[model samples]
Target: MAGAGGSSWVPWYEHASPVLYLEQLLGNVLKEVDMPLEERDAKLKFADRLQSLTQKAILKEYPNTHTNVALRGFGSFASGFALKGSDMDMVLMINGPDKEKLNFKDIANALKQSFKADGLGVYIISNTRVPIIKICEKPPAWFWEEQEKLETQAAVEASAFKAGDGKNVVGDGANNSETSHSMTNAGVSGEHSSESEAEDEEEKEARLRRKRVTEMANKTNAPKNSKVWYRERKLGKSDFPKSDAGILCDINMDNPMGLENTHLLRCYAACDVRVHPMATFVKAWASRRKINSSRDGTLSSYGYVLMVIHFLVHIIQPPVLPNLQHPQDWPGLQDLLHDEQSQFFADAINGHWIHYVRNVDALNYYGSKNISPNTMPVGRLLTEFFSYYGDPISGGHSWQGHVISLRTRHGGVLDKGEMGWNRATSEMVNGIEVRQRYLLAIEDPFETNHNVGRTVTNEGAGVMRREFKRAVSILRGMIGRGTPREDLMEEWVDKVVVDEGGQGEGNVGRGPVATDGPLSITASLARIGM
Candidate 1:
């Protein structure tokens, strides 16, 4: 498929091939939509600060307590796949007897009080299934005042520098400099006549006055620093209903499985160069199709990540990644250790489940291997991933029909019998009763009994499969015979512009999707077919 350019050179499928078009498409989409590095860094830094402040709050609440308080993140932030403005998920670990004595409700109350005392925004969602304190920091009055002062000083300095160069900053005659100075601060450039200058000044004054009024009204209506303040003032405090010390709390701080899973996913990313890009693209794609939230009866981002890892480990020929938890060929001869799977996740506490991954062993084994035989272009892998998950309606296997397990390190189908995942069996996972739905079985790498895909409904799964086929159709068109890549890209732009807000039912608060119908991509490919 050579273009107008002259060449004795044929396209190399892996390197200098037509697949490069797909690569560029994915890269450009990611660059335009994904979170920037600076934003990610700033969010991470803020998370760190929040964590530190939370720990200090706990210590302040209990000065003489010997309990060990540790705050660890567990969501997209910890997993390194965070998008722009993703919420932070943190687990406050209270080890020692304090965990038993100080319940989640108590901790939530203490945290709320402490955060509010510092004027930080805090919402304690203790009534939910998982109690969590959502925190955000707003600029205090002094902070905004300081920023305004800095901006004014910089603007004055710039005006003075211009004046020293012997140029009159033109504006209204008497208030010319003043108007020009204000205009400069507002990032307006050009000379203004006297009448226009007066109008601008009046508008600016009105805006400032309105802003001050709004600030004053907000301050007047602000909540008291603590509940005790209302009590001290005797301001309707007697009529207020009293809350129990630890009522309606749902968070399980003692459990570390969620945090450990985040670590495992991060380790997978660290061990493989392709994992991050591939996972990110898939997550973004799922978001675009509106199938990334478990709360809405679809798979979570983590579930999609597990699927990518499974494909890399088992589905692809020669396997791009080796199974880190595989118990094959003992590297360090701890002679006592016989079985691999059992030994890896056998840790527990007080009959409660605990998982500890041998990160060092996993990294050393998989990171060092040369998988050149398995190496494929990222574009092809992405294409195959969509095709595999979104096989046509006359399907051999779809995400809804079959389970994707990373535990199946060896290439083949894994039956439900092997893993013992079904409705008949039930187990207490981190203090919650978990039963296998067999709907979209994704075995938790560490907590093997837990099904991360239990949230995926039949409808959600169907939507995801259809979207997969749709993506395959789109990509195939771009690489199809006699189709110019630029023409296809232009079509993509046009399609997005036209279909901006009209994405079909069950699609709201999600990334973009195409309303285009599916065509035959799997039938056309000769070398590989899902």
Candidate 2:
């Protein structure tokens, strides 16, 4: 009944601390932007169905060579930072074939043909370093139902086998006869006849138990509506068409590093409950400001997430998050470092060592220890975050000639010149010359050679810098005026529209200024030296 800011018309400055008000505002925004539980479950189920269909299609196409195929979800979806309308990032692992020898084009073509009749849209992108197949729509309901049936049967068979001796137990009359014929072929005629008869009786009882279980399952799990009740119950969705069909998925054959990074982020997120909400809020803010697209020469969502993590881990006092990748920081990881069998062992990917503390349970409450606990509210942390990156004089990070490296245990800042990413360079990509810039260098945690901010162009970097400054200015103006939390949030996320006459300063325009009273807002910002 009360809107996001509450029922009070009075400004927050009149009754509460501005920092507290800001926190309440951020919490409200998260409530608005956070993905609903039903939606999250639906997307996960869609991913499962997609993986199943992909494995089935690949195996059917290359029945002889391909032994098994597996699809793994990664990126935001896997890392628990996914928001509404987020696309699914997945990696496809193919067994029983040499990865280099496998033709990506052939595999893509085969998949396209297999899913053509199912009304699924598939496209192969061959121009990139790693060829990928993109699925634009959810598979038909029948496809999902087919996979569910196979899973149920496999589960029943496994249960029945486990109930008996570990040997392969056939549950049908034809298989029993075949087993008897096989025993006869093995020359078991004289004294072993009694043993064979006893074995037959045991197999018959096992078969009957399996039959009863299957019948009970069929009766209880039968679909009442057009949708399968089993899947609906598992996924917590009445129907899957709407929530699942909007998910765009990309399937790549080789991306072990991506999967590893996804797991690392997931571990970091699990360490602190606040980590996810902070990262998600930053991503949403960047998206609203139009600075989160890497394709158009700006920073990616992944890059923004790294920035947030870096702030919490290195910039803030006592640290809100520990550097999970640093073994020295986490003493529990020392023993696991040398153990090759342990999950903490370094994985060699493309000449880079990918190592991190995989045991999240051990790292829980790492930041809030006896020495100095970082129990800052999310609102205050956010304000500090914006100030640290946006206002250099106010102890913000100096992005110029520096790189944000989460792998570095101390301060998380690396010299761009030392990392050899200070200057712009050009390389051949798909037989075409592409220039790589390090204007906003943010190193990949595992792939030390890769700069996540290489996609940012000079103009894009300027645009991002201006956005940061504008955010600081708006916060100062709103807080100075004792604006309501809801109003402050609205002003922070409102898009700046430049006029067609090109009369604005650095893309600032007359469109959608901070508040209704432009003069008071400008005066407040000027007083803060913005």
Candidate 3:
């Protein structure tokens, strides 16, 4: 509602409408498709099969030592996916992964090949799933080899019971009770020794698999700071910087926040949206949320994911809008019920936990007083927004005025709700800061990245609501927390000083920036709130 649903200057169609479309799309698609009871069971079985392929690919991809690191250090493996049309939705992710290093596509390809060998089509679809958002929209045999890099490599190595899919975790132990003891021979001790060696090899393989999973767990640990962030969400760290895990929101509960929320909105934004794991080439896009940066970049292939979800819908039922012109009409506009994109939407609705919940209020939607949609291209709506962003911290405890810390033009702290004029840096707080960057800039369409920022230093809310991503904000908080200047990186504080042509801390440069905007500080785009 405030600033065109968080942007007064911008059109509501882009920012607010997408949210509605996403929710509607999900609903309609589910109603139409998602399959019969038998089909649902079959797809679940397929999902199980796909999971195996991906795990094997990971084992083949890395050497024992490297695989050990991936599994033990980061807990790397192919997690899972719903399996959309002509594509495979998979994630080759490491828990606590450093988004900067890992390329999501590579991981998907590895698993894709593993599946291909098993006779499954290997298409990488984007945005079918949350987080590991990438998918293979069907790979050619020629490319299968390239994609099979992991699987091929995995072929050479023996497999173990443990695996790492980044999101989930399992110990080194696997269920191989059937072959518990080595077969011993009464006549030949040497043969028995060989048998013992074979058993030892099996044990080693099992350990390797567990190692793979454990390493992945460590890698995808949501950045070490996530723990601290989780705490800050519920308990302000003024007196205690770090503490034991409290009632922190997991942001992991197939969370309505972040990717799940963003993806749903995206479906509405596009015309045949899909929900494949590779939705919108999730690797890079989803990476935006973590690494304390992951802001929706200039281009977030919103179409891929949107279409995939749409495709799934059709597989189950008729399209939401029979003659659908836009995805927003999905599930509601009836016309879309027969649309082409229905294939994707149908499955998502039936398979996923998507439906219309009338209970959410404005406070729960839009996170803080309507800010810009979480992602670009596909803006978010208030109703669906709450599903992802719940009730945020409200009242006097939060800092109401905008603190324009980046550019000295307004001293990086703009109060008085200037967002009415410039929708970028400023926003009206409904309850709490449910997202990362407040506003990139206040210019029309936010064309260039010359906006201001709102500091979440004292904002009250959940752990994920307070993702610690931006270096400026992080540094600002650190400085507030008395982080030593000598130990601090100059790239942190020195970057915040910007004037008329200065950059803002609130909106890290995702879109093109105006020459007149604030200068970017030493750090790159960042996000703190989960």
Candidate 4:
């Protein structure tokens, strides 16, 4: 991993720090909690396939509409912080002259019918602010077989080309064509040993190499027996299909802001290497603690991401990241301002100015150029993050009257009263009484009027705060202790008990907290005079 200025990252233990053990423990915990490479690859491939299929379905179903339709992915998957089995969020963008006349409900119904006709299970939800088409289905047996076959063929061709015998191979086309069709027709069959014994030693080695590559590709592309491959492993409820489907996709039509926000986050993630891992760790912690679901009246994953960004860019001393939305802070803005077509300038979208610095690479080493660059390791950053949010006595963030705002120049902190969101208000929405609370206000960077934490209910806010405090107490207790990394990891990430008897459904119970010895988490907190 590279640090802020693209230098090799120094490990936490290399620093002359007192919390070396804690840093090592947290580093190991991040590794354990992160998604595996294989799983991430499979999920991304599934998403690509689904996007292709959906695009084809739209074109086929609306042949006479003359509309240019495109599907774009957004949210965590696009922002590079997606956990294992995270749902793929996409927008079905329709262009052309008649696009303004199109009805979302009608379009969703048409797409649902088209997907069902193609033997896929789909649901259309039209009552929400933005209509959604939920698609879930296992790829047919032929689909998996074809995928494996194509991957195997490509691997063999790659191996053959690398072995330096491209001329001798007849009509293989592996030397000339990179297309999948050319590779498939390269005269390589499923059987690997069909070559004659009279072949030279070099050819034999190439054949053996091809066979090994093919086997590995087949293993990776083969479909697994498990159904609902995208469901979370630990907590929360997933409405995704429980059958042998390998992916779940949510398609919407009216959320271009989501795509913009995803790009904004991607740029922020590109600023520093520590940003992604820290955000992922915090998100996993929130999910495990049962406070990550917006539908269940808590903060969404996007809100947590904003919180992490706020901490890194504004709250932390000698910020680990620059506010990409702040044009004055970015030196590259001068060039972009002269370019009329540059997206770096704000666009008037839905009565809001949606803008951010899109060319992240141009502002090279902006983080490290600060008067006092933050050279803290990911472990130290994470520790400070927990302290800032959880331990109020440590002179950290106080969520009572303040709001989290990433767009602000003043430390990402805003007064709730100044924003006119000081108290809870109830309004009628679609004939139902809807309540909006400012308990945990988080202003969206672009859509400044939208509070990302409006879904957090009073009880949900309490639960989240409690979890935050618990994390702070436990981490404090475990710091400097010679506890095994595995034990510390389990205590932090895996040791959670669901409070079924609590007022809310997925409330977390306070179990044994972090301690190297026999003392409980509560006892450790008492020992530290918390």
Candidate 5:
């Protein structure tokens, strides 16, 4: 709403509509951060080609086996929050009973060889918590591979339907029994033809006679239920052999639930129109502030996403997001909480409580039924988000003492103790040490035992809070004062200097303050109820 009219700027809040300002702000932010559709599509195509090559190489190395090698997209690529040039996170799922015999080192070696042969730069980093192979860019033959794939698909489709005199057979008899038998042998045929039709007429007739004799004997020997026999035959010739145990036994691994989390975020975005822009703006802000990297002792992108969700769900005046995972009407949730695993006390004798709730359909729908649609201006929400989390110590307590949990509705806060989190104690689950960090506590929506905020250190959290406050101040100043839109928009991120318990704390009109403004620091503070 603070548009420049003939070089004279307008105050944002006093403008015709606050939503207009939010729309403009989001448009500007997205123009800077969002990847173009064409570029995103090209990158995805490159990833698919690279994955195909890797799969072919692995299969070649371990030939004549039931090894099912595939590259599954994860992380931001699968999630909707990917930026331009964001590295794709892919997981190699080697499915099959014999997959246990395949060594991860061998797989890595095969990937290395494939990348080398293609003349692409690749790094096989297997030392980390989750092993990954980093690829520089798409290979030179990527376009060629795409073209070849298209041609091969066309040929396959053409071959699937061919001219026949009167009667026709469909698919190779070995692999197409189910559909082949179901189809009529008239002029209409399937996309695939039977391989046995290529044999000499005499040999085919002889084989048919032998099959009839065998069927007669088997029918007499078989049980009364013919459907069971058909079902067995239908499922018998699966490509991947079954293991003795029910489990896949491929590396005896834990499921990568990251894909599920990605789906959850995608649903949230689809349900609300405002979530994506808000998330993107926060990501850009975090990137500018240099507090977004986990390696730098701060939060990861996922951490930032969780933070945004927390604000939208709990901090807003009328909650923008519903407590999907632990809604008040969620069935069996009350009884689930009474279970021993959800109850954790220091001296409890049974076991350490690990809160793990799987509410699959909670995020299935996004529109608000509990509360009205939160149509608050995005700009105001952004300011409030920063203000709420910016202050390290507010209301006579630090953020470390509180927990940001979706389980508690009505914008509620759950203490760390009741949530089975403590800094003084550590527990071992499945040979991995689980320790709680009191710096910041963010309960995982599904896996309650896991604190997503554990990655944030004490100093790192303080820095982030300070940055948030600084952002709030700058944005507030830009809106309150009739600052030249261009001047405030330009290099605004660079102007927020981190205060080290020194001067410039609440010192208005200091670095990037507008020269003329009606609003004051006191007014901004009052807005946030500080």
Candidate 6:
């Protein structure tokens, strides 16, 4: 019931519905992200600010223009309402056929200056990278679900999942079968199968699961009798949407597997807000460029950390050799070619896992410290991977060679932060209008490792993934039915693994030493005396 659901509005500009009219109120809506309490009056007063900020962003870029750009949807989390925290997220779109390059970053930057605040993000068409900006004044808290509830004014809307009959192929069973016969009102059909089922079985199961999840999206009686609408049926599901690569956040938060990392990222977008550039950057890059529109940059696509895990788990861990001496491994090239896990890794990492991790992590996770260049971000991950592959000290690295790794990494750059180059106006910052460097320091598992302007920190990101997965699993299992709503980061932080010495620094040796560099598989083996 909450969310755009299936109601595709034809942009206000398309219909020219001038229903509500009175006085044009305007100002920064995020002025109260830090505010503790916000009443209705306070929220109504902020609505004008939302209109002004959005309008100013448009006007500053498109001056003397009557051609209104039809807005399709607000940036994720449906920004464009008086959130409980007193913030407003607005979606600005142009529905015309002219595909001229629209720079969302520039517009976002301008808005930061005009509003004299921070914490603003702008995403374009869900295709291009969205830019986040902050406005002056204290604001309140807001979530993506709440936005759908208030804006659509419906408990449930048609799911994009069900909308995928022709374009989207939802298999019949948990294996994702093509022709699914089983049908459940909840949409969950078919019996559970073995995890080691054949491809056909997997496909069948996957399809049924997809439909079931979508059907379940509409029903909301699982929690305290509270109903929540769900969308993005086929897109996928996880604690963190696509990437879902969580580690340990900060040990201080507790629960080594997952705890506080997710909390910090979603907590306050007021004074400090940083995104994992890789997540947002690659997403915007693909969207702006219109690449892989079906799944976009999912874990199977752009999740940097998970990609690394796959390579280690498949290729190097149990390296597919010319012969499987023990019979358990993929012995011949033919077997390797058909290996499911290997294929998954290939589809995810694209052959050279080293090249993929090195380049993407350099940008996404920040590789400038511990043992590599300050210019790149994936500093520690590369060393770990190389070492894992028995080739850490090898100097033969460049982020080139493989095409899959190359394109994925090259696509990781955000052209200089997630800001739009053109089509952006209005600016503001920190309660005063000024310019400041966009720092991508925090780590958020939900975002790309490359995205720097996220609210979650690196420690938090690793743990957030673990927590998100745990939360989803725990809540689902506890009630014997799935409920999308789960605990926040703060709750988990209180239960982190104190043994890791907080921040999950379990003697990893402050990360890698500068002495470590690129080497060969043999050299790595020699060093480890393997």
Q: On residues 262-330, what C-alpha lDDT tens digit does candidate 5 reach at each position?
A: 555665565456677888888877775566654334566776777787788777766776555554443
Provide C-alpha RMSD values for all models, in order: 20.7, 21.9, 22.6, 20.0, 26.1, 29.0
lDDT of each: 0.50, 0.58, 0.27, 0.59, 0.48, 0.25
Sequence-dependent TM-score of model 4: 0.67
Relative to the true structure, candidate 4 has a C-alpha RMSD (angstroms) of: 20.0
Indicate the worst ten consecutive residues by lDDT in candidate 5.
188-197
Per-residue lDDT of candidate 6, residues 1-530 (tens digit): 23387776442211211111000000121231222244444543554555566567667776755545432222212211112232222334443333244555565555545543333221111111233232323322332343334224311222444565342222223412212211111110001101001222333344354345334432422212111111112321111122222110100000111111112212211101112222222222222222211111111112232223223223232221111112233222233334443332111111212111111222222212221112222222222233332221232211111111212211212232233321212233222221111212211222223221211222322332332234233323323232224321121101101111123211211221222112212211111000
Compared with the true structure, model 5 gives a TM-score of: 0.58
lDDT of 4 by residue, 1-530 (tens): 78988888753333334245556655765677676788777767766766677667666656667677777777787778887766677777788886776777777777776676766655544334445676766544444354355546656766886798673332342321212322111111111101110011212233343344334333432212210100112211123444467676777675667777888888888777778888988887787666676544567788899899999989887788867777667453455545555346478767778777776554434433432267887777877787788876667777777888898885789989988988887665443344556778888787786667776654467667776776665666554564433332333332212222233322333222223211123322111111
Off by over 4 Å in 6: 1-45, 64-66, 69-83, 97-105, 117-130, 139-530
The better-scoring model by lDDT among 2 and 6 is 2
Rank the models by lDDT, top first: 4, 2, 1, 5, 3, 6
Q: In candidate 1, what are the lDDT values of residues 1-530, reduced to their tens digit?
A: 45566654432222333466667767876675567778677766766666677688778777777788877666567778766545556667788865566667677778777766776544433322334454555523443344355446546755886779654433222322222222211111111111111222333333343344334333432222200000011111111112221111112244465666676677667556778788887877676556665534466777888889888877766677656566452243232135363255556533445443345455534555643356787777876676666553434244433556675555534556566654434444333333334567776665555566655444344455555656655555554452333322331110111112323322321332223212222321111011
Q: Could you tell me the lDDT of residue 54 within candidate 6? A: 58
Residue 16, candidate 5: how far off, in angstroms?
A: 9.0
Q: What C-alpha lDDT, on a 0 to 100 scale, does residue 472 get in candidate 6?
A: 30
Provide the lowest-lDDT 10-residue window in model 1. 226-235
Candidate 4: worst-modelled 10 consecutive residues by lDDT? 189-198
